[model samples]
Target: MGKGRAPCCDKSKVKRGPWSQDEDFKLISFIHKYGHENWRSLPKQAGLLRCGKSCRLRWINYLRPDVKRGNFTAEEEETIIKLHQSFGNKWSKIASKLPGRTDNEIKNVWHTHLKKRLSSKTNLNVDEAASKGSLNEEENSQESSPNASMSFAGSNISSKDDDAQISQKTFEHILTFSDFTEMLQEVDKPELLEMTFDIDPDIWSFIDGSDSSFQQPENRALQESEEDEVDKWFKHLECELGLEENDNQQQQQQHKQGTEDENSSSLLESYELLIH
Candidate 1:
């Protein structure tokens, strides 16, 4: 294991706990006047008794003027949950996607509020994976614990057939339950007839292609910025959906003239409908 960062100052000497108004003023004032490029020297230079780390946290989480102080907006919270799904426990990376929010604040919010919200939203556990004890003895044994949580990346769920198993296609990557119900409701109720796919060539390629050979629409060149996380997620979802449907069609001998089955085709339509 790597050595931890050694404390810069003696712990007993530095002040701790809630910052006084004067301390806040001093930290903010010093930062504004002479930027906090070097946090180690900041406390001594600013004439504050707090440690450099404390000063940094104070400025970042509480003292920053642009810091959003009120309750998080609904959209902000939703963004956090989605980002968490994409990047587990990567608070700084997640915070980077959300402007004016510090990693510390986001971490606290997740622990205090969002964690419960997510659990309530998706009560899925790893028991489904553990039940397939034959797959990997070690993996299943570890997963059988009560505290075991589901990490849905490439996770599998067993089917009714004892001899045969069905691949779950990493339900997390395909359609996260957070938005799955929402998507299903839209499918069940076709209120919005107006829909279009202003899809990036990169994303549309997976959806519009025929057979195993993937084709880029219009032979369009894909730049780095052409696609994003959500786009990639949908692309994977569509590809897996097609493969799953195709497999079912083969099993049931329900092949049509087109490469994709009816269910996959209808799903593609639904996806393209809400693409915009």
Candidate 2:
């Protein structure tokens, strides 16, 4: 309509319409024989009435041997969605991942199918904004007052506690499953248990496991320090156990008060039982 980039095709003497089957056969035969020498000059050379642009588009979009025309699969649709999410409107790049599917085909599929699917998920798309708003509110609350700072610190500690409790709950749930129970039984079976417990007896007796190796002076000092640490750990364990037993006895001695210490003692006993 607007003189159109100085007319690649001869506007005065070219034909344009739906290509005939004979026309398709001639175009295909010409391309196969001569390999489309020049698409601009192809219409005249090949004795086709269609414009070169139409010929090129037809060859590229439909008549090309490599063009794969079929129904899209579920897997292909999923791949398209993921590709689209990562690179919006990048039809050419998207087409590269999907063999035989042209950029034009990919673009059409996205417009007709994927675009509608995403349009229906507007609420899901806004969830990120909602989460961000919640985070900002938390920050503002934390910055409001001294009391708010203390409350935020308490919340941080509580969150850590919640995470630990949730992890423990999840572990318990997993342990309750039949497969996990079977796995536990397999691990606890006499042979497996013994194999796991039976470490190399001479493991700690070597410096890098070489029989004739002499330890460096620094290594000897470090080993001595570790020995002291082992002795200290044993002493600490004994002290803790003694304190726990004393606390239990005191809770029993003060049964009339029904105090927090008694509850703590009962909880510790339950923990010991569970561990065993």
Candidate 3:
């Protein structure tokens, strides 16, 4: 038969609560002389009335000479937040980037303070977007029944959410791009106003669904109907202009193609100007 899982500790035999100063000393003295290669046996060798798990925690979190005590520095806190972003809930990994800080400590600080700080910033961005979109979002209490002007807090997406969830929820915000607008408005210097847009020259044909490989499912039916009407209109124009079905047919086709290309180019240029 397979060996059963090894027990971590015995609750009845070893100390469970906070480490006393003597407990700390023994754990530290033993680790200082003999490194903690195997934590499961460290406590028994050190002669502490505690489990190896307890000894490990005490040494790592408090008793070690290199462990930083007192409140964390602002820089350290910022580092933890950035590390959390990259590492998710891997506290041990986050702690490694931060010297003298334990995973447990980092985990605690994240839940207690850092989470709300992040959520508040996300909410602020949403509120700013809403204000930019519509004046109806604002409630001037003074204008209605003599009430004071008030704004409600924006809805918050939980930090527990994964990247995909955040992306899906914030897609609407992505389309509006209020943040870019704000950045442009904030620019006071002349050089900052300069901008450029690089795009494919043939994208208009793709939008028209002339490209066999690409068509958006939501607008596929509408595009087909629209294409039919456009074809009819162009044929009508050709007839009204008295184009021959001979050499003049080629010229008519060229004129139609030129008009379509010019319209697409103008549309793109206008979009670029709006962004700038």
Candidate 4:
């Protein structure tokens, strides 16, 4: 036999494979009325023959109210690809960043679709390069080709124009000092202000000022002094807000740790009872 104790649910008594409609309804109803903290005892209370682990998986992966179904969007696919590259196979961490997506769903999608797509693309690129073998010939053709030269020059000019347009549009949307101050005054939560300004301090130099026109020496000196004061005030606010966020995060982590400990103890006790 294996190292661990026998299964919690009696194989002979419990209904296995796909769950029936009645089982689904009962599980959902029971969980809705009373939460799923003590999963091992939940099946008996809910009149379910399924094991606690099965019930937990069903609720987490399929039956939850907030679970999103249907095809993934193009943006979501891109995000998954980027996150997968950075985090490797840590599906749970990646799922945390994507709301309504479970680790199981992401793992299935990656294995079924994205992985195959990437492999096919890589193979296609390799075949194309192999068929066009000589690097020297390719270079010579490019040097003598008027069409290639024109295409390259045109592409460079178009890329530069696109970049400039994007930069202008981005600058137009950047917050001015007056707008920032007004937002801070309007927001009720310190956390909101912290998130809004959670960027590099150096970017503050690009923030729009009240006056853009050239001014006399005396007026310019006064403007500089006022800007310095505003910068100091913003820095102080950011520091205080950061401290508040840290404290809140610490409290949340402590609570989560305690909850996990309690759940582990409950699960162990339930398992021992089942084994005995």
Candidate 5:
């Protein structure tokens, strides 16, 4: 929050830069013995020569027992990417899903690692396609029979369709990242130091209305309102297909039941294997 009202102490008086092992031990022991009742009082109470903000950061990011250190696994990386893709610049929100990971750690990994990975993959794909040999009409005809040509044409169309869908998803992800970065800059201002996430539950329920099992009736109403807006094309298609609202409702019920059953069966089998 822009140095938190000039840090309330002289910069030279307080310890700065990376926290040392002794500082960590002192912080952890202090936290365990006295607890973090108040940040301002904590430093003096804990006998640390650091500001309250610095103490809090060191505790949360490093001293906290729950904070996972070391390298992120491939699975964790994938999870982080998917969560970021869904949540945009909500690094704290994404970090909540991943136990033991700090929001700052996740953010750094996204910026330094995941972004480079996606860029490289996109470049590699482009390079590979460019390296492929082009074919003349005669060569194309010679390489494939009429049936095969028809199949190839169909595949080409399908590939084009998938490319369009993928392009849209990629563009949305990029927009999300851009928007989040802009938001991060804005929120880092001095005025809005304290932010609330009380509306997140409401927002998430609205976005993922299809998962009715996880929502309350009040939340479901919000979900339905948003669903009405989000699935406009799907609703139009349903109407064109002459499917009534009741039919669609029944279909959703069946789909949910099938999914639940499959999940239960899978979990039960895993449990049985463990028991055996």
Candidate 6:
């Protein structure tokens, strides 16, 4: 015998497979009239032949008013990529940041499309070479001069995957000081080497202050200009609507005045005819 209890609904009585148009209408109408309190009992209340779980999925994924269908935008794709990198496979958390997108939808898109695209584009060989070169240079500098600070020139590695790998390797190499020292000791003649790692004080200052340096004055001014334009657009819309309302009120007043004048003229003409 099965360990668990019997199923919630009878499989024969409750419908299965794709939901019809009539089923969608009933589910939407029932939820709109009375909100989804108990999902298990929702199908019974809504007169749906399907199980509660099925009804819930249909409502959440398709029938809900706010559910956004169709293709994802470029901004949405970027957000998904960034959020996935940070949170891994936490689709629900990722979906929360992107309005109208569901966890299931995001998961499907990532697995089916984005993952393949990323894997196909990633390259690892060039990254390993660059990292090895940097490590060797740093070790040579330390062996040649104890007081020297290490410096590395910017690499022209355009691929994001290559950059990521380089960073990972550099971080790991920094953590292993014993390996660095051992490599330095292996050098045939330590005294004969004349490697210079004399990093300038100005370079140190630049590196330390890079965070603030990136937020340039021109970028801030541009952001402010964008905000101002948005405010101006909203104000223009308000002014146009106000003018239209005022014009409508004035037109109504003029029509009322004209009707009163016509009524008075007819009454005066009737009075004159009666006197004659």
Q: What's each prediction's TM-score? A: 0.43, 0.42, 0.43, 0.44, 0.43, 0.44
Q: What Cα-based lDDT does every candidate model obtain?
A: 0.50, 0.49, 0.48, 0.52, 0.49, 0.50
Query: Per-residue alpha-carbon lDDT of model 4 for 1-276, expressed as tens digits?
Result: 767987777778877888754466467546544557688889988889988888988877766533445455444555677789999999986665555467899899899877886677567776656633543355455556553322112111232355334333323434556565554444325454334333222122122232221122335555555654444333323333333434554533433343333433443344333222
| Candidate 1 error regions (>4 Å) | 1-6, 124-276
Provide the RMSD of all predictions against the true structure, rounded to 1 decimal.
21.6, 32.0, 27.6, 22.8, 22.3, 28.0
- Segments in model 5 whose C-alpha atoms lie over 4 Å from true places: 1-8, 126-276
Q: Choose 1 or 2, whichever is better by lDDT.
A: 1
Over all chains combined, what TM-score does candidate 6 have?
0.44
- Per residue, candidate 2 scores C-alpha lDDT tens digits across 1-276 of 676577787776887877754455456545544566578888777778878998988876665544445445444565678788988898877765664457888898888987786576564676877854664575465456453311111211232355334333322212112343244345334455333322111111111122111112334444444443333322222223333344443432333233345434554343333222
Candidate 3 lDDT tens digits, 1-276: 447966777878888897653455456445534557778888887777888887878766755433444455445566778788899999987766665467989899999987987777667786765643443333222225322111101123345655345333423222112332233233312343222110111111111123121212455454345544334323322222222222344444443444434443443343233222
Q: How does model 3 fare in lDDT?
A: 0.48
Estimate candidate 1's RMSD in Å.
Answer: 21.6
Question: What's the CA error at residue 136 for candidate 5, in Å?
Answer: 35
Candidate structures ordered by lDDT, highest first: 4, 1, 6, 5, 2, 3
Task: Spell out the clash pairs found in candidate 6.
Answer: none
Among all windows of 10 consecutive residues in model 4, the one with the lowest summed lDDT is 150-159
Specify the highest-TM-score model's number: 4
The sequence of per-residue lDDT tens digits that candidate 1 reaches over residues 56-153 is 88877765533434445544565678789999899987766554467988898899988986575457555655533432464355556532432222
The TM-score of candidate 2 is: 0.42
Name the candidate, 2 or 6, with the larger lDDT value. Answer: 6
- Estimate the overall C-alpha local distance difference test score of candidate 4: 0.52
> Candidate 6: minimum summed lDDT over ten consecutive residues — where?
195-204
